[model samples]
Target: MKYILFIIITLTAIFSFSQDKEKEALLAAKKANNYVYEGNNLINEDDFVSAEKEYRKAISEQGTTVAGIYNLGNSYIKKGSYEEALYRLDQAAKIATSKVEKHKAYHNIGNVLMENKKCKEAVEAYKNALRNDPSDEETRYNLGLAKICAEQQKDKEDDKKDDKDKDKKDDKKDQEKKEGDDKKDQDQKDKGDQDKKEGDDKKDDKGKPKDEKNDKGKGDEKEKQQPPQPRPGQMSPQQVKSLLEAMNNQEQKVQEKVNAEKQKGYKIKTEKDW
Candidate 1:
Protein backbone atom coordinates (compact mmCIF):
# COMPACT_ATOMS: atom_id res chain seq x y z
CA MET A 1 0.00 0.00 0.00
CA LYS A 2 2.86 2.40 0.65
CA TYR A 3 4.33 1.63 -2.79
CA ILE A 4 0.99 2.56 -4.43
CA LEU A 5 0.94 5.92 -2.51
CA PHE A 6 4.51 6.64 -3.64
CA ILE A 7 3.54 5.99 -7.27
CA ILE A 8 0.65 8.48 -6.98
CA ILE A 9 2.98 11.13 -5.50
CA THR A 10 5.49 10.64 -8.32
CA LEU A 11 2.77 11.10 -10.96
CA THR A 12 1.48 14.29 -9.26
CA ALA A 13 4.97 15.84 -9.16
CA ILE A 14 5.62 15.08 -12.84
CA PHE A 15 2.26 16.57 -13.86
CA SER A 16 2.98 19.79 -11.93
CA PHE A 17 6.45 20.10 -13.54
CA SER A 18 5.02 19.62 -17.06
CA GLN A 19 2.43 22.31 -16.48
CA ASP A 20 5.08 24.76 -15.22
CA LYS A 21 7.31 24.02 -18.21
CA GLU A 22 4.49 24.67 -20.69
CA LYS A 23 3.71 28.04 -18.97
CA GLU A 24 7.40 29.02 -19.12
CA ALA A 25 7.53 28.17 -22.81
CA LEU A 26 4.45 30.29 -23.53
CA LEU A 27 5.87 33.23 -21.63
CA ALA A 28 9.17 32.95 -23.50
CA ALA A 29 7.36 33.03 -26.86
CA LYS A 30 5.34 36.16 -26.02
CA LYS A 31 8.19 37.80 -24.18
CA ALA A 32 8.40 41.40 -22.89
CA ASN A 33 10.97 42.02 -25.68
CA ASN A 34 8.35 40.95 -28.24
CA TYR A 35 5.84 43.53 -26.93
CA VAL A 36 8.47 46.23 -27.16
CA TYR A 37 9.35 45.12 -30.67
CA GLU A 38 5.69 45.27 -31.66
CA GLY A 39 5.25 48.74 -30.15
CA ASN A 40 8.39 50.03 -31.95
CA ASN A 41 7.30 48.56 -35.27
CA LEU A 42 3.89 50.31 -34.98
CA ILE A 43 5.55 53.59 -34.12
CA ASN A 44 7.90 53.34 -37.12
CA GLU A 45 5.14 52.47 -39.53
CA ASP A 46 2.75 55.08 -38.00
CA ASP A 47 0.17 52.32 -37.48
CA PHE A 48 -1.42 53.97 -34.44
CA VAL A 49 -4.53 51.80 -34.71
CA SER A 50 -2.70 48.48 -34.53
CA ALA A 51 -0.07 50.04 -32.26
CA GLU A 52 -2.64 51.15 -29.71
CA LYS A 53 -4.28 47.71 -29.61
CA GLU A 54 -0.90 45.95 -29.18
CA TYR A 55 0.21 48.39 -26.46
CA ARG A 56 -3.05 47.89 -24.56
CA LYS A 57 -2.66 44.09 -24.79
CA ALA A 58 0.91 44.33 -23.58
CA ILE A 59 -0.08 46.49 -20.61
CA SER A 60 -2.85 44.06 -19.60
CA GLU A 61 -0.61 41.00 -19.81
CA GLN A 62 2.26 42.59 -17.87
CA GLY A 63 2.29 43.43 -14.18
CA THR A 64 0.90 46.81 -13.23
CA THR A 65 3.51 49.44 -14.12
CA VAL A 66 3.25 53.23 -14.61
CA ALA A 67 5.36 53.05 -17.79
CA GLY A 68 3.07 50.49 -19.38
CA ILE A 69 -0.12 52.23 -18.36
CA TYR A 70 1.23 55.66 -19.33
CA ASN A 71 2.41 54.34 -22.72
CA LEU A 72 -0.95 52.77 -23.29
CA GLY A 73 -2.69 56.00 -22.42
CA ASN A 74 -0.49 57.87 -24.88
CA SER A 75 -1.38 55.36 -27.57
CA TYR A 76 -5.08 55.90 -26.91
CA ILE A 77 -4.57 59.65 -27.10
CA LYS A 78 -2.83 59.35 -30.49
CA LYS A 79 -5.84 57.40 -31.70
CA GLY A 80 -8.12 60.34 -30.64
CA SER A 81 -9.62 58.24 -27.88
CA TYR A 82 -9.56 60.80 -25.06
CA GLU A 83 -11.95 58.83 -22.86
CA GLU A 84 -9.90 55.64 -23.14
CA ALA A 85 -6.69 57.50 -22.34
CA LEU A 86 -8.35 59.19 -19.36
CA TYR A 87 -9.57 55.83 -18.02
CA ARG A 88 -6.13 54.17 -18.20
CA LEU A 89 -4.34 57.16 -16.70
CA ASP A 90 -6.91 57.31 -13.91
CA GLN A 91 -5.91 53.74 -13.01
CA ALA A 92 -2.20 54.67 -13.10
CA ALA A 93 -2.97 57.54 -10.65
CA LYS A 94 -4.18 55.17 -7.91
CA ILE A 95 -1.13 52.81 -8.14
CA ALA A 96 1.02 55.35 -6.29
CA THR A 97 2.83 53.49 -3.51
CA SER A 98 5.18 56.52 -3.09
CA LYS A 99 4.23 60.20 -2.55
CA VAL A 100 6.06 61.21 -5.72
CA GLU A 101 4.15 58.61 -7.73
CA LYS A 102 0.85 59.98 -6.39
CA HIS A 103 1.78 63.55 -7.34
CA LYS A 104 2.75 62.58 -10.90
CA ALA A 105 -0.53 60.77 -11.35
CA TYR A 106 -2.60 63.74 -10.08
CA HIS A 107 -0.61 66.21 -12.14
CA ASN A 108 -1.17 64.25 -15.38
CA ILE A 109 -4.85 64.01 -14.59
CA GLY A 110 -4.99 67.81 -14.47
CA ASN A 111 -3.55 68.05 -18.00
CA VAL A 112 -6.04 65.49 -19.29
CA LEU A 113 -8.98 67.38 -17.78
CA MET A 114 -7.67 70.64 -19.22
CA GLU A 115 -7.53 69.07 -22.71
CA ASN A 116 -11.14 68.01 -22.31
CA LYS A 117 -12.25 71.62 -21.51
CA LYS A 118 -13.11 70.57 -17.99
CA CYS A 119 -11.34 73.38 -16.10
CA LYS A 120 -13.15 72.67 -12.85
CA GLU A 121 -12.10 69.02 -12.84
CA ALA A 122 -8.60 70.05 -13.88
CA VAL A 123 -8.49 72.46 -10.93
CA GLU A 124 -9.44 69.70 -8.53
CA ALA A 125 -6.80 67.36 -10.06
CA TYR A 126 -4.13 70.04 -9.83
CA LYS A 127 -5.14 70.73 -6.22
CA ASN A 128 -4.69 67.03 -5.37
CA ALA A 129 -1.34 67.04 -7.12
CA LEU A 130 -0.23 70.05 -5.08
CA ARG A 131 -1.35 68.36 -1.86
CA ASN A 132 0.90 65.40 -2.67
CA ASP A 133 3.65 67.73 -3.86
CA PRO A 134 3.15 71.40 -2.90
CA SER A 135 6.48 72.50 -4.38
CA ASP A 136 4.94 72.35 -7.88
CA GLU A 137 4.32 76.01 -8.91
CA GLU A 138 2.64 74.95 -12.19
CA THR A 139 -0.14 73.17 -10.31
CA ARG A 140 -0.70 76.24 -8.12
CA TYR A 141 -0.96 78.55 -11.15
CA ASN A 142 -3.39 76.21 -12.89
CA LEU A 143 -5.49 76.03 -9.72
CA GLY A 144 -5.60 79.83 -9.57
CA LEU A 145 -6.80 80.04 -13.17
CA ALA A 146 -9.56 77.55 -12.45
CA LYS A 147 -10.60 79.58 -9.38
CA ILE A 148 -10.90 82.72 -11.52
CA CYS A 149 -13.13 80.94 -13.96
CA ALA A 150 -15.30 79.63 -11.11
CA GLU A 151 -15.50 83.05 -9.47
CA GLN A 152 -16.53 84.76 -12.71
CA GLN A 153 -19.35 82.27 -13.13
CA LYS A 154 -20.45 82.87 -9.52
CA ASP A 155 -20.38 86.64 -10.00
CA LYS A 156 -22.54 86.41 -13.11
CA GLU A 157 -25.11 84.35 -11.21
CA ASP A 158 -25.09 86.78 -8.32
CA ASP A 159 -25.63 89.72 -10.66
CA LYS A 160 -28.60 88.03 -12.26
CA LYS A 161 -30.16 87.33 -8.86
CA ASP A 162 -29.59 90.91 -7.80
CA ASP A 163 -31.27 92.21 -10.93
CA LYS A 164 -34.23 89.93 -10.36
CA ASP A 165 -34.58 91.04 -6.77
CA LYS A 166 -34.37 94.68 -7.80
CA ASP A 167 -37.11 94.19 -10.35
CA LYS A 168 -39.33 92.51 -7.76
CA LYS A 169 -38.74 95.30 -5.27
CA ASP A 170 -39.48 97.96 -7.84
CA ASP A 171 -42.70 96.22 -8.80
CA LYS A 172 -43.73 96.00 -5.16
CA LYS A 173 -43.01 99.66 -4.60
CA ASP A 174 -44.93 100.63 -7.73
CA GLN A 175 -47.93 98.63 -6.55
CA GLU A 176 -47.84 100.31 -3.15
CA LYS A 177 -47.59 103.73 -4.74
CA LYS A 178 -50.59 102.98 -6.94
CA GLU A 179 -52.58 101.90 -3.91
CA GLY A 180 -51.71 105.08 -2.04
CA ASP A 181 -52.65 107.23 -5.03
CA ASP A 182 -55.96 105.43 -5.33
CA LYS A 183 -56.70 106.00 -1.65
CA LYS A 184 -55.96 109.69 -2.04
CA ASP A 185 -58.17 109.87 -5.12
CA GLN A 186 -61.01 108.19 -3.23
CA ASP A 187 -60.64 110.63 -0.33
CA GLN A 188 -60.81 113.58 -2.70
CA LYS A 189 -63.89 112.09 -4.37
CA ASP A 190 -65.58 111.69 -0.97
CA LYS A 191 -64.77 115.27 -0.01
CA GLY A 192 -66.16 116.57 -3.31
CA ASP A 193 -69.39 114.60 -2.76
CA GLN A 194 -69.78 116.07 0.75
CA ASP A 195 -69.30 119.57 -0.62
CA LYS A 196 -71.87 118.89 -3.35
CA LYS A 197 -74.38 117.72 -0.70
CA GLU A 198 -73.81 120.85 1.36
CA GLY A 199 -74.41 123.04 -1.72
CA ASP A 200 -77.72 121.20 -2.34
CA ASP A 201 -78.71 121.80 1.32
CA LYS A 202 -77.97 125.53 0.87
CA LYS A 203 -80.26 125.55 -2.22
CA ASP A 204 -83.02 123.90 -0.12
CA ASP A 205 -82.60 126.56 2.53
CA LYS A 206 -83.00 129.25 -0.14
CA GLY A 207 -86.30 127.59 -1.29
CA LYS A 208 -87.93 127.68 2.20
CA PRO A 209 -91.16 129.70 2.95
CA LYS A 210 -90.31 133.38 3.28
CA ASP A 211 -92.84 133.98 6.10
CA GLU A 212 -91.30 131.32 8.32
CA LYS A 213 -87.84 132.67 7.55
CA ASN A 214 -88.91 136.31 8.02
CA ASP A 215 -88.72 135.94 11.86
CA LYS A 216 -85.02 135.24 11.51
CA GLY A 217 -84.53 137.30 8.27
CA LYS A 218 -85.80 140.90 9.00
CA GLY A 219 -85.87 142.74 12.37
CA ASP A 220 -87.25 145.93 10.70
CA GLU A 221 -90.19 144.09 9.06
CA LYS A 222 -91.05 142.36 12.35
CA GLU A 223 -91.11 145.65 14.23
CA LYS A 224 -93.18 147.45 11.58
CA GLN A 225 -95.73 144.68 11.02
CA GLN A 226 -96.42 144.11 14.73
CA PRO A 227 -98.31 146.59 17.01
CA PRO A 228 -96.26 149.02 19.17
CA GLN A 229 -96.17 146.87 22.32
CA PRO A 230 -94.25 147.65 25.48
CA ARG A 231 -90.90 145.94 25.65
CA PRO A 232 -89.60 144.15 28.80
CA GLY A 233 -87.23 147.05 29.43
CA GLN A 234 -89.92 149.75 28.68
CA MET A 235 -92.23 148.49 31.47
CA SER A 236 -89.68 148.08 34.21
CA PRO A 237 -90.54 146.09 37.37
CA GLN A 238 -90.31 149.19 39.68
CA GLN A 239 -92.54 151.32 37.38
CA VAL A 240 -95.16 148.50 37.22
CA LYS A 241 -95.12 148.22 41.03
CA SER A 242 -95.73 152.00 41.46
CA LEU A 243 -98.55 151.98 38.87
CA LEU A 244 -100.31 149.11 40.74
CA GLU A 245 -100.12 151.04 44.02
CA ALA A 246 -101.61 154.12 42.40
CA MET A 247 -104.43 151.98 40.92
CA ASN A 248 -105.22 150.57 44.42
CA ASN A 249 -105.45 154.07 45.95
CA GLN A 250 -107.75 155.21 43.15
CA GLU A 251 -110.08 152.21 43.74
CA GLN A 252 -110.38 153.01 47.47
CA LYS A 253 -111.18 156.62 46.64
CA VAL A 254 -113.81 155.50 44.14
CA GLN A 255 -115.50 153.23 46.77
CA GLU A 256 -115.66 155.98 49.41
CA LYS A 257 -117.14 158.47 46.93
CA VAL A 258 -119.80 155.97 45.82
CA ASN A 259 -120.82 155.29 49.40
CA ALA A 260 -121.16 159.07 50.11
CA GLU A 261 -123.25 159.51 46.95
CA LYS A 262 -125.49 156.64 48.10
CA GLN A 263 -125.99 158.25 51.48
CA LYS A 264 -126.88 161.60 49.86
CA GLY A 265 -129.50 160.01 47.57
CA TYR A 266 -131.20 158.02 50.42
CA LYS A 267 -135.13 158.68 50.83
CA ILE A 268 -137.07 157.84 54.06
CA LYS A 269 -140.41 156.03 53.64
CA THR A 270 -142.73 154.52 56.21
CA GLU A 271 -143.50 150.96 55.06
CA LYS A 272 -144.54 147.87 56.94
CA ASP A 273 -143.19 145.56 54.26
CA TRP A 274 -139.57 145.45 53.10
Candidate 2:
Protein backbone atom coordinates (compact mmCIF):
# COMPACT_ATOMS: atom_id res chain seq x y z
CA MET A 1 0.00 0.00 0.00
CA LYS A 2 2.89 2.41 0.75
CA TYR A 3 4.52 1.62 -2.64
CA ILE A 4 1.27 2.44 -4.49
CA LEU A 5 1.01 5.78 -2.62
CA PHE A 6 4.57 6.69 -3.54
CA ILE A 7 3.88 5.85 -7.23
CA ILE A 8 0.84 8.14 -7.26
CA ILE A 9 2.87 11.05 -5.78
CA THR A 10 5.61 10.62 -8.44
CA LEU A 11 3.01 10.71 -11.25
CA THR A 12 1.49 13.89 -9.83
CA ALA A 13 4.89 15.66 -9.71
CA ILE A 14 5.72 14.74 -13.32
CA PHE A 15 2.35 16.06 -14.60
CA SER A 16 2.76 19.37 -12.73
CA PHE A 17 6.22 19.89 -14.19
CA SER A 18 4.94 19.19 -17.72
CA GLN A 19 2.10 21.70 -17.31
CA ASP A 20 4.50 24.36 -16.01
CA LYS A 21 6.76 23.94 -19.05
CA GLU A 22 3.76 24.22 -21.41
CA LYS A 23 2.62 27.42 -19.68
CA GLU A 24 6.09 28.91 -19.95
CA ALA A 25 6.23 28.10 -23.65
CA LEU A 26 2.85 29.71 -24.21
CA LEU A 27 3.93 32.89 -22.37
CA ALA A 28 7.16 33.11 -24.44
CA ALA A 29 5.26 32.63 -27.70
CA LYS A 30 2.81 35.36 -26.69
CA LYS A 31 5.68 37.80 -25.92
CA ALA A 32 7.43 36.93 -29.21
CA ASN A 33 4.19 37.50 -31.18
CA ASN A 34 3.73 40.91 -29.51
CA TYR A 35 7.22 41.95 -30.57
CA VAL A 36 6.58 40.73 -34.14
CA TYR A 37 3.38 42.79 -34.19
CA GLU A 38 5.28 45.88 -33.06
CA GLY A 39 7.92 45.26 -35.73
CA ASN A 40 5.25 45.09 -38.41
CA ASN A 41 3.82 48.40 -37.25
CA LEU A 42 7.27 50.02 -37.35
CA ILE A 43 7.86 48.67 -40.89
CA ASN A 44 4.54 50.19 -41.97
CA GLU A 45 5.80 53.55 -40.68
CA ASP A 46 9.09 53.07 -42.72
CA ASP A 47 11.11 52.95 -39.45
CA PHE A 48 13.18 49.93 -40.59
CA VAL A 49 15.85 50.47 -37.94
CA SER A 50 13.33 50.26 -35.10
CA ALA A 51 11.58 47.39 -36.84
CA GLU A 52 14.86 45.45 -37.00
CA LYS A 53 15.36 45.90 -33.23
CA GLU A 54 11.88 44.65 -32.51
CA TYR A 55 12.29 41.63 -34.79
CA ARG A 56 15.58 40.76 -33.08
CA LYS A 57 13.83 41.02 -29.69
CA ALA A 58 11.11 38.71 -30.92
CA ILE A 59 13.69 36.15 -32.11
CA SER A 60 15.47 36.36 -28.74
CA GLU A 61 12.22 35.72 -26.88
CA GLN A 62 11.30 32.70 -28.99
CA GLY A 63 14.10 31.33 -31.18
CA THR A 64 11.76 29.13 -33.20
CA THR A 65 9.36 31.98 -34.13
CA VAL A 66 9.08 31.90 -37.98
CA ALA A 67 7.41 35.34 -38.17
CA GLY A 68 10.28 36.95 -36.24
CA ILE A 69 12.98 35.50 -38.50
CA TYR A 70 11.05 36.27 -41.70
CA ASN A 71 10.30 39.83 -40.53
CA LEU A 72 13.93 40.41 -39.63
CA GLY A 73 14.93 39.26 -43.13
CA ASN A 74 12.44 41.74 -44.65
CA SER A 75 13.82 44.51 -42.42
CA TYR A 76 17.35 43.72 -43.72
CA ILE A 77 16.05 43.94 -47.28
CA LYS A 78 14.54 47.35 -46.51
CA LYS A 79 17.88 48.45 -45.11
CA GLY A 80 19.71 47.28 -48.29
CA SER A 81 21.59 44.60 -46.42
CA TYR A 82 21.08 41.89 -49.07
CA GLU A 83 23.57 39.35 -47.72
CA GLU A 84 22.07 39.47 -44.26
CA ALA A 85 18.56 39.40 -45.72
CA LEU A 86 19.38 36.32 -47.76
CA TYR A 87 20.78 34.56 -44.71
CA ARG A 88 17.72 35.22 -42.51
CA LEU A 89 15.24 34.50 -45.30
CA ASP A 90 16.96 31.24 -46.12
CA GLN A 91 16.75 30.29 -42.46
CA ALA A 92 13.07 31.20 -42.32
CA ALA A 93 12.28 29.14 -45.42
CA LYS A 94 14.12 26.12 -44.05
CA ILE A 95 12.19 26.24 -40.74
CA ALA A 96 8.79 27.39 -42.07
CA THR A 97 5.97 24.85 -41.66
CA SER A 98 3.57 26.36 -44.20
CA LYS A 99 3.58 26.56 -48.01
CA VAL A 100 2.54 30.22 -47.94
CA GLU A 101 5.54 31.12 -45.79
CA LYS A 102 7.92 29.23 -48.07
CA HIS A 103 6.51 30.92 -51.19
CA LYS A 104 6.97 34.38 -49.67
CA ALA A 105 10.54 33.65 -48.64
CA TYR A 106 11.45 32.20 -52.05
CA HIS A 107 9.84 35.07 -53.90
CA ASN A 108 11.79 37.65 -51.90
CA ILE A 109 15.00 35.66 -52.43
CA GLY A 110 14.39 35.87 -56.17
CA ASN A 111 13.94 39.66 -55.93
CA VAL A 112 17.19 40.06 -54.01
CA LEU A 113 19.04 37.85 -56.48
CA MET A 114 17.63 39.90 -59.35
CA GLU A 115 18.83 43.13 -57.69
CA ASN A 116 22.30 41.62 -57.49
CA LYS A 117 22.27 40.68 -61.22
CA LYS A 118 22.25 36.98 -60.54
CA CYS A 119 19.54 36.39 -63.13
CA LYS A 120 20.11 32.66 -63.53
CA GLU A 121 19.92 32.07 -59.80
CA ALA A 122 16.94 34.38 -59.57
CA VAL A 123 15.15 32.29 -62.21
CA GLU A 124 15.66 29.19 -60.08
CA ALA A 125 14.47 30.97 -56.95
CA TYR A 126 11.33 32.22 -58.69
CA LYS A 127 10.74 28.74 -60.03
CA ASN A 128 10.92 27.39 -56.47
CA ALA A 129 8.45 30.06 -55.35
CA LEU A 130 6.02 29.04 -58.06
CA ARG A 131 6.44 25.40 -57.09
CA ASN A 132 5.09 26.24 -53.63
CA ASP A 133 2.31 28.47 -54.98
CA PRO A 134 1.68 28.01 -58.70
CA SER A 135 -1.09 30.60 -58.65
CA ASP A 136 1.34 33.52 -58.04
CA GLU A 137 1.35 35.67 -61.16
CA GLU A 138 4.17 37.86 -59.77
CA THR A 139 6.60 34.94 -59.51
CA ARG A 140 5.79 33.85 -63.04
CA TYR A 141 6.39 37.33 -64.41
CA ASN A 142 9.68 37.61 -62.56
CA LEU A 143 10.79 34.23 -63.86
CA GLY A 144 10.23 35.34 -67.46
CA LEU A 145 12.23 38.51 -66.91
CA ALA A 146 15.06 36.57 -65.26
CA LYS A 147 15.26 34.22 -68.26
CA ILE A 148 15.66 37.13 -70.67
CA CYS A 149 18.30 38.81 -68.52
CA ALA A 150 20.26 35.58 -68.19
CA GLU A 151 20.31 35.10 -71.98
CA GLN A 152 21.46 38.67 -72.57
CA GLN A 153 24.24 38.27 -70.05
CA LYS A 154 25.34 35.04 -71.72
CA ASP A 155 25.44 36.70 -75.13
CA LYS A 156 27.46 39.60 -73.77
CA GLU A 157 30.00 37.18 -72.26
CA ASP A 158 30.22 35.28 -75.58
CA ASP A 159 30.92 38.50 -77.50
CA LYS A 160 33.68 39.43 -75.10
CA LYS A 161 35.24 35.97 -75.43
CA ASP A 162 35.12 36.15 -79.22
CA ASP A 163 36.84 39.51 -79.21
CA LYS A 164 39.54 38.16 -76.93
CA ASP A 165 40.12 35.16 -79.20
CA LYS A 166 40.37 37.39 -82.25
CA ASP A 167 42.90 39.57 -80.49
CA LYS A 168 44.97 36.53 -79.58
CA LYS A 169 44.98 35.31 -83.17
CA ASP A 170 46.02 38.73 -84.51
CA ASP A 171 48.83 38.97 -81.98
CA LYS A 172 50.07 35.50 -82.87
CA LYS A 173 50.15 36.36 -86.57
CA ASP A 174 52.04 39.58 -85.95
CA GLN A 175 54.59 37.82 -83.81
CA GLU A 176 55.15 35.12 -86.43
CA LYS A 177 55.58 37.66 -89.20
CA LYS A 178 58.06 39.61 -87.13
CA GLU A 179 60.05 36.48 -86.47
CA GLY A 180 60.11 35.61 -90.18
CA ASP A 181 61.28 39.10 -91.12
CA ASP A 182 64.00 39.00 -88.51
CA LYS A 183 65.21 35.62 -89.77
CA LYS A 184 65.31 36.88 -93.35
CA ASP A 185 67.32 39.94 -92.33
CA GLN A 186 69.73 37.76 -90.40
CA ASP A 187 70.22 35.42 -93.38
CA GLN A 188 70.97 38.35 -95.70
CA LYS A 189 73.45 39.72 -93.22
CA ASP A 190 75.16 36.34 -92.92
CA LYS A 191 75.38 36.00 -96.72
CA GLY A 192 76.84 39.51 -97.06
CA ASP A 193 79.43 38.70 -94.41
CA GLN A 194 80.35 35.45 -96.19
CA ASP A 195 80.76 37.23 -99.56
CA LYS A 196 82.93 39.92 -97.97
CA LYS A 197 85.13 37.25 -96.37
CA GLU A 198 85.59 35.48 -99.74
CA GLY A 199 86.51 38.77 -101.43
CA ASP A 200 89.08 39.52 -98.73
CA ASP A 201 90.66 36.04 -99.13
CA LYS A 202 91.40 36.75 -102.86
CA LYS A 203 93.22 40.02 -102.13
CA ASP A 204 96.72 40.77 -100.80
CA ASP A 205 97.57 42.95 -97.80
CA LYS A 206 98.42 45.87 -100.20
CA GLY A 207 94.84 45.83 -101.56
CA LYS A 208 96.02 44.32 -104.90
CA PRO A 209 94.81 40.97 -106.26
CA LYS A 210 97.03 38.06 -105.10
CA ASP A 211 97.22 36.39 -108.61
CA GLU A 212 98.32 39.69 -110.32
CA LYS A 213 101.04 40.32 -107.71
CA ASN A 214 102.38 36.79 -108.05
CA ASP A 215 102.52 37.06 -111.93
CA LYS A 216 104.49 40.33 -111.66
CA GLY A 217 107.08 38.68 -109.39
CA LYS A 218 107.51 35.74 -111.82
CA GLY A 219 108.06 38.14 -114.78
CA ASP A 220 110.83 39.96 -112.89
CA GLU A 221 112.63 36.65 -112.15
CA LYS A 222 112.43 35.58 -115.85
CA GLU A 223 113.85 38.90 -117.03
CA LYS A 224 116.82 38.53 -114.65
CA GLN A 225 117.65 35.06 -116.09
CA GLN A 226 117.75 36.33 -119.76
CA PRO A 227 120.37 38.57 -121.73
CA PRO A 228 120.81 42.17 -120.72
CA GLN A 229 118.45 44.49 -122.51
CA PRO A 230 119.22 48.09 -123.73
CA ARG A 231 118.27 50.81 -121.32
CA PRO A 232 116.07 53.67 -122.41
CA GLY A 233 117.74 56.68 -124.20
CA GLN A 234 120.77 54.52 -125.53
CA MET A 235 121.91 54.02 -129.18
CA SER A 236 120.42 51.18 -131.27
CA PRO A 237 122.35 48.35 -133.09
CA GLN A 238 121.69 49.91 -136.55
CA GLN A 239 123.33 53.25 -135.56
CA VAL A 240 126.51 51.43 -134.40
CA LYS A 241 126.82 49.59 -137.75
CA SER A 242 126.58 52.81 -139.82
CA LEU A 243 129.39 54.51 -137.82
CA LEU A 244 131.83 51.52 -138.43
CA GLU A 245 131.42 51.73 -142.21
CA ALA A 246 132.22 55.43 -142.32
CA MET A 247 135.52 54.91 -140.38
CA ASN A 248 136.77 52.22 -142.87
CA ASN A 249 136.31 54.53 -145.88
CA GLN A 250 138.34 57.33 -144.28
CA GLU A 251 141.34 55.01 -143.53
CA GLN A 252 141.51 53.86 -147.21
CA LYS A 253 141.70 57.40 -148.53
CA VAL A 254 144.70 58.27 -146.26
CA GLN A 255 146.68 55.18 -147.42
CA GLU A 256 146.17 56.13 -151.09
CA LYS A 257 147.62 59.58 -150.56
CA VAL A 258 150.81 58.25 -148.89
CA ASN A 259 151.45 55.78 -151.76
CA ALA A 260 151.17 58.50 -154.44
CA GLU A 261 153.84 60.60 -152.65
CA LYS A 262 156.33 57.69 -152.61
CA GLN A 263 155.90 57.05 -156.42
CA LYS A 264 156.72 60.68 -157.23
CA GLY A 265 160.04 60.52 -155.29
CA TYR A 266 161.17 57.32 -157.14
CA LYS A 267 160.62 58.96 -160.58
CA ILE A 268 162.70 62.00 -159.61
CA LYS A 269 165.71 59.85 -158.45
CA THR A 270 165.69 57.82 -161.74
CA GLU A 271 165.95 60.99 -163.76
CA LYS A 272 169.00 62.09 -161.77
CA ASP A 273 170.80 58.77 -162.38
CA TRP A 274 170.23 59.12 -166.15
TM-score of each: 0.44, 0.71
Per-residue lDDT over 1-274 for candidate 1, one digit per residue giving the tens place of the 0 to 100 score? 9999999999999999999988976784466446656875896787987776666666666655555566667677667677987887778777757778778777777777777867778788888899899998988888888777767767888999999999999999999999999999999999999998776665545664346366566877877898676686698667789999999999999778778777999644435675
lDDT of 1 at 185: 100
- After superposition on all CA atoms, how large is the RMSD of candidate 1? 13.0
lDDT by residue for model 2 (136-185), tens: 99899999999999999999999999999999999999999999999999
Steric collisions counted per model: 0, 0
Question: Which regions of candidate 2 are displaced past 4 Å?
Answer: 1-6, 205-274
Give candidate 1's TM-score: 0.44
Off by over 4 Å in 1: 1-47, 156-274
Task: Write out the backbone clash pairs for model 1.
Answer: none
Which model scores highest in lDDT?
2
Error of 2 at 253 (Å): 56
By summed lDDT, the worst window of 10 consecutive residues in model 2 runs over 265-274
